[model samples]
Target: MSSTTNYILGVFDDEDEVLHAVSEVKSKGIKIDEVYTPFPIHGLDTAIGHERTRLPIAAFMFGTLGMICALSLISYTMVFDWPMIIGGKDFFALPNWIPVTFEGTVLFTAFGLVITFCISNNLFPGNNVEPLDLRITDDKFVMAINLDKNKLGQDEITKALKSSGAIEVNVK
Candidate 1:
C-alpha cells in the first residue's frame, strides 16, 4: 500500500523561464520536486543541482566482461575444444580473435547502457508514468513541487511560482 502525494505543477512556456524559476524558487527555500521538459535543456540539470550520471562506467564494465568472455571462448575453442590449423596460423591465434572480441565488446556495451538507463530511470515494462500535463512531453516545461513535503500554503506556493515567472500554476 502506498500513499498519494499532492503537488503543484508550475508551467513555463520558455526554457529560460524554467531555468530562472528553478534558481528563484530554490533561493526562496522552496524545494522543487522535479522538473520535466519536452527536450533536453542545456544547463537546466546543473541549475537544479542534479549530479552527473555514471552510466559510462557501467558500459565500460559490461564491455570488459564481454571482452573477457570472448577471449576465453575463442582461446578455449581454438586451443582446447578442437585444435585446428588454418592458413598456417597458430592454434592460439590472437589476431583471429580481434574481430569477434571487438564485436562482443560493442554489443555488450550498447545493451548494457540501454538496460542501465531504463533501470536508472525506473522505466520497467508495464510501468505507468503519471504525467503532470500532456503538453509537458510535447512543448511545455513543468516543475513539480510537493505541497505536503514542502509544508507551504497553497497561496504562498502559487505566489512563489508566479513570481518566479511560471506561466501557469495548478495543483494536482
Candidate 2:
C-alpha cells in the first residue's frame, strides 16, 4: 500500500519562539511530527515529550564484553599459550592487564555507541535524505506537523502557528 502525508512546516526566527510554539501546539492538542534547530536547545526534548535515551546502557554492555575479551586474551597468551617470566611476574599478570583492558573498554564503548546510534536512527552511509529547508541548519528553527494526523483544519493550524510566533508557515 502507498502512503501519503501532508506536512506543515512552521518557521521560527528565534529558538525561544519555537520552544513556546511547541508548548502551545501541544496544549492545543496537536501532535508534532518533528522539530529542527540549528543548535541544541536546552529542555527542548522535555518540551516535546521525548523520553530519555538508553544508549548509555548499550555502551556499558559493550564495554563489559570488551573487558572480558581483554582478560581472556591476556590470560590465554601469557598463562597457558606461552608462559612468560618478565620481571619475575606471575603467569597471569593482573597488573599488566590493566592498560590493555582499559584501552579495550574505551575502544568498544566508542565504537559501539557510534554503530548503535546509526542503526537505531536508520542513518547510514548514502541514505536518501528528506527535503528540509537549509536555513533550519543555519539559524532558523523549524517544526513539522503532520496535517493528516491533526484533527484541526488548515486554517486553524495556521492561525495557531502564527499566534505561537511562527515567522513563516509552508505546506509540503
Any idea what lDDT model 1 has?
0.89
> Each candidate's lDDT (Cα)?
0.89, 0.89
lDDT score at residue 113, model 1, on the 0-100 scale: 90
How do the residues 1-172 of candidate 1 rate in per-residue lDDT, one tens digit apiece? Answer: 0138788999999998999889999888888888999999999888888889898789889999889988998999999999999899999989889999999999989888998899988899998876878999898999998887786688898999999998899988
After aligning candidate 1 to the native by TM-score, how far in Å is the CA of 129 from where it should be? 1.7
Q: Please provide, for model 2 over 3-120, each residue's C-alpha lDDT reduced to its tens digit, 9 standing for 90 to 100.
A: 3678888999998889989999999988898899999999999999898999989999999998998889889999999998999888987988899999999988999999999999
Q: Report the lDDT of model 2 for residue 26.
A: 92
What's the C-alpha lDDT at position 93 in model 2? 77
